[model samples]
Target chain A: MTLERAVAPAQRAVDILGGDVSESALKGYLEGLPGVDAVGLEQRAAGLGTRSIKTSSKAWALDRIIELIDLTTLEGADTPGKVRSLVAKALVPDASDLTTPRVAAVCVYGDMVPHAVEALGAAHGDPDQGLVSVAAVATAFPSGRASRAVKLADTRDAVAAGADEIDMVIDRGAFLSGRWGQVFDEIVAVKDACRKADGGYAHLKVILETGELNTYDNVRRASVLAILAGGDFIKTSTGKVSPAATLPVTLLMLETVRDWHRWTGEKIGVKPAGGIRTSKDAIKYLVTVAETLGEEWLVPHLFRYGASSLLNDVLLQRQKLTTGRYSGPSYVTID
Target chain B: MTRLTVPKTYKLYLGGKFPRSESGRTYEVATPAGEFLANASLASRKDARDAVVAARGATGGWAGATAYNRGQVLYRVAEVLEGRHAQFVDEIVAQEGVSRAAATAQVDEAIDRWVWYAGWCDKYAQVAGNANPVAGPYFNISAPEPTGVVAVIAPQDSSLLGLVSAVAPALVTGNTVVVVASERFPLSAISLGEVLATSDVPGGVVNVLTGSPAEIAPWLASHQDVDALDLVGAGELDWPALEQAAAESVTRVSWPEQGPDAATPSIERIRAFTETKTVWHTKSLL
Candidate 1:
């Protein structure tokens, strides 16, 4: 177990950014990423949403949506019982149907990681084993308002507790104030903190909290900056913000990821977590993903939904497709 | 110059707001003589489901209100119905193709019957519930509670009066209703929705869907969230099948076995949508 094998990916990030890594250089590069045509980008995303994916395609999309969900419960009232039930749901989303696909991960607060991990049990380790992975939101989530030491410690403790992925929030204060190097350094530091004792690194998802980032241009720049800092995923919001995950913002992030893949041949994940509640809305996101990044990004590793209630809606739709009857809230679990 | 007519676009009244059918389907409404009138929204099964959702949302506010407060709201509905008297008469005339006198009689009876039922909102609980003398050393009492969201298939033949008679009694008991209006004569029902909207009855407490009950009733009957199915207006359809569907979900079925109800409203209609709970209390407090 050597640090060099683990630090290879970290070294590549520095090489890709050309080794200068100064505040002004990062600012110059981020400021130079083309300005977004807000109206056109929104119109394109809207146009893509109108493409109907129905019947067998819709049925397939529902199962894929289930697999892509990071079934989340980040409420202040979240308890161990709630996290356990959330994981239970992630394992067999619809208890009525054993064939229902398990969700990609169960996302919770960092402190709740061990509980989710313990609840997952033998089904915890590998997606290939039809298991649900545990994802924890770290670095003073929702609001990234803590010191770098505390944020790193938060990341390390959750990784130590068996969290497969860490969802970290970037410092919007630094990013909005044009402190690109600080934002870049923090993500890189958090990514470094994700290293486990066995020389493995937990997946690092950087939440932009796009609702706080006023313009699409800023979202685009933050997205590219996070990728340059070696984020495995660039998440749209913390779900605590209004306008958490809109189609247009996710579309822009997907485009950034697409371009990054074209230039550097690396595919970064995109997660739109908050307001998407229905199967129809989730299908539209799938359509956007396929059209923007080719079907390659549709997998759980490259795309995910940071959601809780969205899972129930997908289950209801799945039940409708299977039974040819409509379902209600009574049909699904309360969590 | 003669004034041009501006026809009203009839939409489904769901959650107190008027929205077009989810399917965007509308059917032509004509006098029984085959003359054309306005087009009314043809509510689909999904519309019935949406109405059920709306009714479920309003159940808390309507059922939790004090009996006296519910009485006040029902009285307010009667007040609004009275203000819209001429409109109802015209709608009934157009819908049933009956003479003004006949339509007026029906409208008057509907208004009067509604008021009569409204008066019972606070009293039916007392009439349907009572204290019992038991052998144990305890005070035993029984009281009726609303059975939650009720889906009504309003009687198709007696347009205005039947609709009022069927819906008012359920409202009297503080059970929110999602009613499918008389299919052939739905203009008055949609107009009644306007009256309920302004009467403080709350939006979802009385959702009105204007469409074929045959298509909509089955969905409502089978819906798991719907507590009871009132097939009072569903006698014309394959009501036996609706009852079967309701039976599958164990929903309380309200089928008027004797056919068309009596001329006046009955307290039994209110009791049908209530569950009586009996509780025993110790004789002394510690």
Candidate 2:
């Protein structure tokens, strides 16, 4: 309860929620936000998915998607070798064609950040500056079940390891059980932990793990809380759970971000990590973003796709466009 | 009240699921007498690409199965086909404008062809493989392994029999297939797809595409993942160009001139899609 009051920045949201920054106050604020129009939200997402992007526009979307991708490899089996290769792919997504733009970042487990950083070499930095950033999944990632001290340490260690961005999964148990204060404070602390030796903080992406959150309303609330808690981006999943990053959920998150932008005059990014495997699927996300957040959020720093296999599919599509013939997996590197 | 005579929508079978063409284009398949049959998916190059992906994905499991297991799985397909015998017979009669007796004969032959290929699954390796004669202190043996995904363009004239003949042999050797059904007569081929889906044949092991061979064939020929191309059905299309495309990928090409008596099941068809793998086993620990 004290942690909820301790967060000074979320006071921006506190004013709208109630007179105070109490746990009950924020809970009421979230619960009071209009319940999701389930059918309408879904219909809008599906309608956006049907937009026909082709020819030059398709070529453009494919290249833009490559730039917006957070090329990720998160597994128990992930080795330094795997991180290096992932970084290499992020640097040069298609070896066959040098014209292919690099991905925004290479996402890895916090421990593998150094390898990604080393592999990226001089090319590592802000994606907006034409360099691929290294994003580390921290704070007991894929499941935020660790203590507060360990979670903060994980984030700081990743920043120390040269991660330019931290992808943190929120404690769903706290968020689901209505301990809104604890969830909000943890995100604030994780955001604080992103500070580097130079005092500049790494970008923080808070994963809601919407598949476990159980409802569109919860996803919207979590997205709003993450944004108010100083998350630079509100991500949809850790890519560990089933039903991750479906169109409707992403649409809901995008709407929250859109609404936040409308109220605060600041844009919060949304990254839909899992199940977005094909170039076609990624393009649908692009269409949704363009329609919701306008053309500017389409940039690498403002928007991103957290994916591993999606790059290869984009490469295959690129090859198809270039050669006027369908390319196969043999043409692209195996993830 | 009159009962509705519902027609089955013929879609392309890709990775064991029936999907309309990615191009969203369907061509009207007419009977030999010019009567209109159902619209068949005019599978574009994209659908062929998808089919190859499915076929390639199925290769590891299908090829690694014991020869006896493959035979049993294929025989299960025949069992399913036997149950749906009347459907294939009716479609064949309608599409080919053939006599009910002739259509029934064709359907029966198609089922028998599957059984024959199924039986050969356990025996083809024995007939095709050999004990290598190499000068070494080792037992050198040559075994036949499925070449990988085989792209077969079914004969346009004899839809069901030709498709069964071309595809079954490739499958018996554990090679997954992406067979293009006859553009003009695709009914029986799709019914066969239903049989495979209901049987033990794994999804992606046999992707049946119904479209223009000329449009879909070149993509499969040049696809690096496709290990072999059987163009026996490519007699009507510009087949030599397909062979040229297949040559670029180093994919083995099989374009034997099929006779007018319809496709005769051949051991060579099976041989055409199997790679000879030689292994040197140490005679004893030195």
Candidate 3:
């Protein structure tokens, strides 16, 4: 079977649950989800973190990591100029080296989506060449404290502004208060908001803010909840909290995707944003994905790093591998 | 009554923590008379890479410190070393096969050398920096700045004194180091790590790895993150090949003068691991 044929089942599973499930039914489905063994999960992730990837494999992983990056800049000081520069970086990561792959997407705040869309569109003149996607974080990101109507509008504004992906944050207060149904509905609503007027829709990435969820069981439940509520991807954090995107947390999420695939035949992407600043850390996440989920999930569509400085380090390592000499931060753009 | 003797594990000092080499390989260090001293971590290329990373991470903080503050931190190292004088003297005696008096003298000199370099921390810039008189309508000034991370091959013969002489200048000038300690007498170097950890020198500012210079030096020499290399302790290793490897990264290579002059302290040693940055600004008449 072709790749598209294989992916059809997963899309169909998502379509079948489109905004129709009741709150108690969602609660029953999420509560029935298996609990995560914290210590065992942490130990397994630590063990896999020691996997030695070297030389050719290291180079390959670096290149693949560049492609999987959601080159992000979510700051209060974000401007149109900054977004345009970031978009240019996403289009041509390393101008000195033409072989460097473009990043998976350029992630910005919902307000900056139009700047990214325009910049990316201008960079890639030919539509056949596959322009970089613009991913915008919405739903009162990092906090998820806004009302449902406001959250839905935030996501809709980004999609209408031409963002190809919507990264919405789940209400941690609801998830922590055992209001799992409310959290599920919020994701469902945000996913609905991702649909553009042209019938095309942006892929929805649900941010669990696992750092605030406070337990591996909650992380697992949130994972299953997001996937069921039509999240195209499940992200660990909003990159605003401490203890964001740890190895064990990512491992638990990857396992969720693995089991989700087994039961529903649907594939969901995993993104571990924040505190992952080095190339080694990026490769370790890739190792986790490959070992936990399988090689199929290693692609950009399945894995992503919501990181900003990580790209420069990857570029430096790539240059060192290719030229047998290290390149400094001065050699790369500061996006 | 029989007693159970617990020997110390001589681990590599990276990022201010004593960790066994990531490779988990160690080689036995014995006295000249063939009595086993301890198992020293046989550091691999990966350890060197880690040290470089640590040094790179530390460069910003260390270099950003005020010269007076850096001087105080270096002086603190001497203060810690003075308290641990006897321990270092005993290790030097066992490792270098020196007399009690000679070992004591070596430890004294090492401490004194550290003190000497500590004073130079705030003085090197004044002595080496200059205000150049450019003919154009601009004010130009030149001053010395650290060359970031440096890789050092600590002198082999005088383990304690040589190690101190090689390391003090680099630390004093605010350039963090990855020093390959004396292979035959690594105990003193590992013990020095104890003093440094307690001192305010900051972790990764002076990383010491006790392993073969031949095994670990090449990795340090080739490391792209390392900005300079001091081959004072390279001993009889193939210096030319290491220099060639260093050239790959355009790393500034420093080979101490041969014979007695090598032991002499000078501003040149500090300048070797420093980059002279000159800034020009337009002198506008308002």
**Model 1: how far is A275 from its true place, Å?**
1.7
How much is the lDDT of residue B102 in candidate 2? Answer: 95
Q: Residues B1-286, candidate 3, lDDT per residue (tens digit)?
A: 9999999998999999999999899999988899998999998877888888888889999999999999999999999999988898889888878899999988898889888999999998999899899899898989999999999998887768888888888887789999999888888898999899998888989899988889888878877678999998775798888899999878999874355345556777888889999999999977
- Candidate 3 per-residue lDDT over residues A1-335, each given as its tens digit: 01231221124324545644667756776777778888899899889988888799999999989988999999999999999889888888999899998888888999998888878765532112445678899988878888888988898999888777889999888888888778876777777777767665577888989999888988898888888777888999999999889999999999999987887777888999999999989989999998988888877678889999999999988988988654566678866
lDDT value, residue A260 of candidate 1: 91
The 10-residue segment of model 1 chain A with minimum total lDDT is A1-10
lDDT of 2 by residue, A219-287 (tens): 999998898777888899999999899989998998898898788677677899999999999999999
Question: Sorted on TM-score, highest at the top, how do the candidates line up?
Answer: 1, 2, 3
DockQ comparisons of all candidates to the true complex: 0.57, 0.56, 0.37
Screening candidate 2 with a backbone cut-off below 3 angstroms (N, C-alpha, C), the clashing residue pairs are: none
> Taking the tens digit of each residue's C-alpha lDDT, what string does model 2 give over B107-139?
899899899989999998899888887787788
Each prediction's TM-score versus the true structure: 0.95, 0.93, 0.90
What docking tier does model 1 reach? medium
Q: What's the TM for model 1?
A: 0.95
Q: How accurate is candidate 1 locally (lDDT)?
A: 0.87
